[model samples]
Target: MHDPKKLEEGFGDLANEQQLVKEQDHTRNFDGDEKEDSRIGTNQPMEQNQDEQSRQQQTTAVTSKPKNKRIATLDAFRGLTVVLMILVDDAGLAYPRIDHSPWNGCTLADFVMPFFLFIVGVAIALALKRIPKVDAAVRKIILRTLKLFFWGLVLQGGYSHAPSNLSYGVDMKFIRWCGILQRIALVYMIVALIETFTTKLRPTTISPGFFSIFPAYKWQWLGGFISFLIYMVTIFTLYVPDWSFVEHHSDGSKRYTVKCGMRGHFGPACNAVGYVDRQVWGVNHLYSQPVWSRLKACTYSSPATGPLREDAPTWCRAPFEPEGLLSSISAILSGTIGIHYGHILIHFKGHTERLKHWVSMGLGLIILAIILHLTDAIPINKQLYSFSYVCFTAGAAGIVFSGFYILIDIWGLRKPFLFLEWIGMNAMLVFVMAAQGIFAAFINGWYYEDPDNNLVNWILQHVFIDVWKSERVGTLLYVIFAEIVFWAVVSGILHKLRIYWKL
Candidate 1:
């Protein structure tokens, strides 16, 4: 088997090479200062103090190898997020907790997408330090950005009409303009540009007797803050449009739609976010799976009777994607938070300091989320990409990332989750394949169709569901197990061969 170090050459080299450059720069600064001090004929005590400082800086500079190396925790975190994304996307409707919240709250499913974007932010920040040439780097970023957008369109943008008629691809009415990967691409481009110009990740020598509060990427912090402010202002003011929904009377006579505000508007069609999507993309272009409506109906006596009691009003049937255009602004802010963590990882040397910074970031964001929620400034609505939603999820991500870092990097307990590192390494490929039905298609071709139709169902029905007498629990376990095995085999093979798919 190839060494893991050889496989991580891309990210590791950036970190390692930058550490050397930083050390060289620090040495030059110290020596230059020492020579100037000697020429000035400073007192003997001052000379001794300068020499002591230089020695200390050199020692600190040389302690870079371990600190600068690739963080296993980050890769593991990415891998974990990828796996959960695949799971939820593949079979989340069976479980409400794994599915997205109906409207105003978040679920475990919502975290996966934001986490992926956050990891992208972390990666771009680290990658920028290695690619110093602006032109080459910008070109690469642009190309990758375009590719991600194109792939998203290819995978998710097919017309709703079948090719039996000639109106399929030609109709713009059925085309979905925004989707998961598309949103990710947009967020990455925005955050990457900001980090490239505004943020610096190299460690700086602290002056004697001066404790610094800001990390190397303090400019990034400012940028993120500005973005948050813009997001909030838009949410509060611009979102609440005075659009009306047309209502039809029992006699079939139509009346101008009722105009609603933020206070009354709630679900897919009524809310400001959904209204924007409807105006831009039309209802046909939005996500059609109205899970909340169906769940609401299940509680009633009828399964397939009148339309499932919708969470939204009668005007809207199609659900608006959480990854829609309006919410993408907050998505960028979430990614910015991730970039902040990457800065912390590279700049802080002490384990305690790093841990404290991570905890503080998480707590601060959580507190801000609470304040926004309490004031009703912006409710924690995933559909709206509300300010509180971004804060809460980003804060949770920080706490989770910190915990993984401590467990894997600080304590050296990394071996158990190395499989996740492989998944993380090829996370995008796995995700694209899973999302595009490539994995399902491959599995279906080989697996048998038995008592429950497909092999997975057959296995579940025979092994678990039939015995347990609970289709939900059995099917859930089967899907989870199958997803694990699918990714494990794919990731394991790629890991063994050192073959990674990167854009």
Candidate 2:
């Protein structure tokens, strides 16, 4: 009999309490599920992004590493050429075999120019691999040609009488216009233009076959053939008449006459090459010291250069530029041949394939040269820039380049040639400083007693000549140590500091 209202109130309170408990539990479970789902959703994408980033980084590293790597073989080959240049230039007076031939035949020094041109072709192939526009390529080519031409004029244009005479200056009227670099500029311009124009014709995928590569480079080959044919026709067919030149000796000025009214004569004076140079560039503007002066017919001493013979030919004193216009025309073939090799390098991926192609082409050239030279169809003459000479030298260059590829790029034997590679890296700088006598001229500017007694002479006289007690031995050793080794060290330092002087 307690109160009915109180019992009813108690029942309502219990029901309300049970409903509140259920609501609290449901809210707690729902919040936990939401948090767990949120974490899973966020973590899945983050892990996936990390994996993708890792893959991209690996791909980039694998692909870009090759592009960044330097072609050690090519550099080594160029460096070897530079070394040979220094050796021949400095030691040639002592060793005639390594020196340039008087007129006809080949020597160690004869290969320098052709080798340089070949390398220029190779470089062009690499540099203009992906030209975006034609006008841009032309502009760049012209600019480079002008720079190279200017430098050639300054360096080899008789402006500086270096290593022998401290005087420096030249008469503009009698300035020499043709030289090594000038020839290089010409070859570079022509070959580069040929390549630039033919870029669009290159096949997207290289096909398989022995003669497959030739079809791709047919245009360049055709250009080369036309140039060669022109040279051949002009050299053989052009008529050369009597030419005369004036010689200015210390005693007085004297005029000499060369008796030549003929065609197809490869003699020093009568050749169409010299006649063209004299006619176009003028006698005074040609190279004053011609290699013909060293010929046995002109000089008292046959192999070694000395006083002229009493019965020396009239053309002995005549000015004849070796890098004349006609000879340079023939040089285009060398550049074109080099471009072919560069194509192999560009297209071939495997080391074996590249070596095989290079070796085969080299052998073919050598065989062709042998046939032409042996048959006397075309003599191997450097001064004339004969076709046989071009083929022989270019072939040798290819074989040598392949050897370097094997030793450095494949076998990983680079430490021994590191000095050469360094010089190759800064070849233009080395050419200017060491080969062109600029460094000698600079050192010669600072003398102790007089200009004759300079650091360069002192080093040669004391450190080398006096010590060795033999002129030839001392001269060779001095060149090897002072010029080659010294330049090598300079180039190495520059490479370490990343200071490259490109033209």
Candidate 3:
């Protein structure tokens, strides 16, 4: 046992020194290659090592940055449009002021269609930002267009009657062809194709100092103006001869003849819009209950729908689709205007610049609309889709969109409008389910007593109407609760689950 403890301590010190030397070597050559060298353990080319480190740093920077997202303002505006549509469709009967105008004037409901079309135009601009393959884009667009047309046929083509009847079928011989969705389909197709073909013009290529605010979208504006000219010329020049149609009441069928051999007439009776639809789609295919029926000239009560007046004109009962061919041409201009606004969103980065442009364009449109309408140059008419109506509605839509952008995007106040944003994100789904009454019709099918005593009726009678003791107030509340809030919740859940129904 002579000095055994000292020998063990000496061995431990040697091991510790070796370990520290290895650690220092590893630290010095941290960016070494996979291959090891006997002399230095591992070593890499300095250039390769620098490149790898640069790549890692770039990846980290990219991961740290926030992702670009969809504009919340657009979705919110669309949601607002859907909300208005539901309110009008469900509660318009109780509140006639919010209902569509009988003729020649705009009401709250009258703005709904233009707002919708304007949104479509804006969306088209955003969606078709980069259409590398024209054929593929066209194919996709055509598919969507067909789908829209199909749904329009199913929902508005007399296939499904909700709350009133459980039956679901359409008479092909007498099925209506034109409707809200059908018009939307046509507009989408036209505008999308226009956008697809005109994607060569880059926003940067056009100088901001150019006289035209929308310098890059000049071709689209030209197309829109051409369409307007076509509409104006046809509407004024087309000869609308005397037309006759059979009106079927509960009593029996009555034949009525409208007296008109006019070249220029925008009255409820004799118009080129109705004439073109009658000639192309036939009277049987037209909308049976036109908005013109609500006019004082046609009904006993003005604005509110009522019985036909004793001295009602012959065209009072005639079928006239509001979304006819001639008027749809004017509607294209609305979408074009919307695309111009959207282009501003794409070209401009600064919040102040975007707002200034949008507000200026909106005020200009509003002023033009006032002059045109007040001067009797072109009355603001929804049925005709008059130029003044397009100007006023599109201008209002731009203003509304800009306001939402300020509140939701610029100010970071999105949480308050998250419900609307969700609904807007899943707008087509809500349109089919709530606005179209497919879901209501399905629920109404499950009944307790007779068919009239369905779930929808029961809820209305007991829950809303009975509790309020006022039909109008109850009906409004029911629509708000049953349709708006209910659909908003459904949309929110779908959004959370990442389940979007797109067309």
Query: How displaced is residue 27 in candidate 2, in Å?
Result: 62
Give the alpha carbon lDDT tens digit for every residue of 320-432 in model 1.
56667767866888888887777666666788877887788899888998888778766777777777888888898889888888889989998888767777777767776
After superposition, which runs of candidate 1 have C-alpha atoms over 4 Å from their true positions?
Answer: 1-68, 159-172, 199-218, 239-268, 290-307, 310-312, 445-457
Question: Over the full model, what C-alpha lDDT does candidate 2 score relative to the true structure?
Answer: 0.79
In terms of lDDT, which candidate is strongest? 2
The window of 10 residues in a row where model 2 has the poorest summed lDDT is 6-15
Error of 1 at 80 (Å): 1.0
Report clashes for each candidate as comma-separated counts.
Answer: 2, 0, 0
- Tell me how far candidate 3 lies from the true structure as C-alpha RMSD in angstroms: 15.6
Expressed as tens digits, the lDDT of each residue in 228-272 for candidate 3 is 999899888999999999988799998989999998787888888
Q: What is the C-alpha RMSD of each candidate to the true structure, in Å?
A: 9.7, 21.3, 15.6
Q: Show model 2 residue runs off by greater than 4 Å.
A: 1-66
Q: Which ten-residue region of model 1 has the weakest summed lDDT?
A: 6-15
Q: lDDT of all predictions, in order shown? A: 0.63, 0.79, 0.78
Candidate 3 lDDT score relative to the true structure: 0.78
